[model samples]
Target: MEPNRTRLIGEYIVGPRIGSGSFAVVWRARHRQLGIEVAVKEIDKKLLSPKVSDNLLKEISILSTISHPNIIRFFEAIETREKIYLVLEYCDGGDLAAYIHKHGKVSEAVARHFMRQLGISIFTFWLFIFDQISSAGLQVLQEKHLIHRDLKPQNLLVSTNEVTPVLKIGDFGFARSLTPQDLADTLCGSPLYMAPEIIQNHKYDAKADLWSVGAILFQLVTGKPPFDGSNQLQLFQNILTSTELRFPPGAIEELHPDCVDLCRCLLRQNPVERITFKEFFNHRFLGELR
Candidate 1:
């Protein structure tokens, strides 16, 4: 069968704009020769500052090197004087946020499926970094571990699948690579999903990402975030002062005990008290899904 062709941007046939952000626009495109569909993120260089430009380069580097089915695949990059094009694996089902908004809360089985994929993707980041440090003979100071500082429903893309929709983590603009023991002080991520440590302006490590995961999981089953307020200040205040994670009264009655336990463990205000990645991956709730 002949390939459907469209307006050519470099070697790709650019189709429709699928997404856009402050300085970039993502388009659905196809390789001219291969005819494979891909998402092309076109970034305007003129809109980027020196620091933001450096972060873009780092994002490119991370995407280029990482390989995981649950993480968005980066094919190649094409750069011109004014714009930079990132060719990526195309996800047809949009993002988790939109899916949740359309479908409302999901069943426990479905939520389990999504959480398992997310957990594995997050674990892969740590495994990839540790491998780089040990196998590449890179010095601890030079070798960096990645933290997807911005992990939320919006950042998770869904690819259509026959049996089950596949989830892939995307948007690494706020991601940072630090030494194994390093802690980040930068305040980043959506206020609702941000860890309390970050809200309090305390140095935090990868445990912060786990808190975001809990927030995502909580929303997946409850149809609303674990905490909420009228503004950012109120939101942060709620996150900081609230001692317990609560599910909606009606939602609580429908949730499994293990699922509730997992959320509570992940949402601990103290990073030290929060469940570790190993524990989270092995939690009974996720274990039962396997």
Candidate 2:
């Protein structure tokens, strides 16, 4: 049976469904007494395969421990025999993908603002993940370990509670914890934002996320992905073989040269050659913003 709209899921009063995925449904809900709004993701265990259910629990575990202003806030989670509900901070302003769609690419000034926050958030997230490892006196194999396997515009949300919308990275469903010695072989995430190594089924590390950042930044300034094809097969082939990215005739003229240069560095096909997060953080493009 379908859950009632006005039914209370723990302390939250469920409202209309806000979003849905293959494994879960998100509802716009409000705290009964506090009156604060939230997004409650309801996952029907009966509908989920055991593997998917395990991953969902893992996502909850990751989110519950993370606390960052630029990352989505996780309030709490409740579970029943048949379903699990995650109460998350409501970002009424929606996601970066929809924002880009409406604006047809943002101005460099706006892109600069968003990119700075994105860089900080990405760097900080790794810091939080590594803090525990470092505290245990374990050797830190790499500058980065945790990978947000599905970094893209859609996973980035903007909070409407502020005077200007504040961007926050959301959706931890595809996030993974790895070390330099460990590499991910899972072929996940959107094809357009995927790194060449991921498309080739190569063992990828945190650098793969940096490649996604480049694709997102390129789309932010150009209003389109770097590569386009009629199907996934062609898209993967193009990504594997394409060495350079070309902007539309006038697109390059409108962006700062440093911005274009950063994109190029991040999108390098060779993961070993791609700029590290430290280098990217100190890049001229982001430095100019300061």
Candidate 3:
């Protein structure tokens, strides 16, 4: 319906779907003016109700506020009755999950290279490392008071050159801004990555990102998700009560002990026990970059 604005949105014609999720589809596009390449995130309005629409706009608002080299740049929002288009910086490499799926477990060299690049970007953005990557990222966000309720592997984008998989954390449909007095109760994010407190339907905050990031770290090294069940209830129960912090044998031998420790601290069942970005920044696992 917004075909009129296609000239404003991009020069590159809309090709077949490059990627998609429950809420939107991403297409490779070219800037009509600059004749430059870009990605257009087309969000279907029909898929969302009024409440959902508000949340989607909130995500757009958050994306609009943030500017980081490692984070994908969200240019503008173009809306029509049928669709909502978000013009974003294109990443030819696709997502990290797709890369991992095609390559199996990543080589130690590749993982470290990716981590170090992210470490620098993360340092530059928030200049802190919380219990986990997203958590550390959240510290900067919390300071600004933004909480990303959904954090997962699929949410992270990569570059084709692999110079750095610009960790463009996407899908903020469940995100919210918080205040000192705010106490969140909604349970969101992938069940396998949800924290125990969240699964209990208890009050929590951005600290919940730590749990999801921890799960992501484990999956990064092991190539297997930590939890899976036949049903949603079963998955929630496992996420809520499971006690094991298992990692593949000999996995840590290649990675620094500090990395393992960091993962453990991030994955801690007790949110209180979860490491803070301040402490995590001082961690040796992150390398002595500082």
> Model 1 shows how many backbone clashes?
0
For candidate 1, give the lDDT of residue 154. Answer: 88
Q: Per-prediction TM-score, please?
A: 0.88, 0.88, 0.84
Per-residue lDDT over 92-176 for candidate 1, one digit per residue giving the tens place of the 0 to 100 score: 9989988888888988888888877776323334566567322110111123367888889888998983235888888878887
lDDT of 3 by residue, 1-290 (tens): 46444444434566557888777888888765577777898989889889778988898888888766556778888888788998888878888778778767765456554554333324343443453333224455656777777777777777674634545566677889887578798867778788888888889976787677667766776676667778989887766676867677777676667667777887888888887655655556556553
Error of 3 at 32 (Å): 1.8
| Poorest stretch of ten by lDDT in candidate 2 | 133-142
Query: In model 3, where do residues sit more than 4 Å from their true spots?
Result: 1-12, 107-139, 161-164, 252-255
TM-score attained by model 1: 0.88
Number of clashing pairs per prediction, in order? 0, 0, 8
Ranking by lDDT: 1, 2, 3
Candidate scoring better on TM-score of 1 and 3:
1
Please report how far candidate 3 places residue 119 from its true position, in Å: 6.2
Quantify all predictions' global Cα lDDT against the true fold.
Answer: 0.82, 0.80, 0.70
lDDT of 2 at 25: 94
Model 2 agreement with the true structure over 1-290: per-residue lDDT tens digits: 37553699999988888889887899999999999999999998888888777778778887887766677889999999989999999999888887888787777767766777767423334566667322110011123356788889888888873334777888888777787688999988899899998888889988898898899889988999988889999998888888787787798888899989988998999999999877876678876322
- Residue 67, candidate 2: Cα error in Å is 0.4
Question: Is candidate 2 or 3 superior in lDDT?
Answer: 2
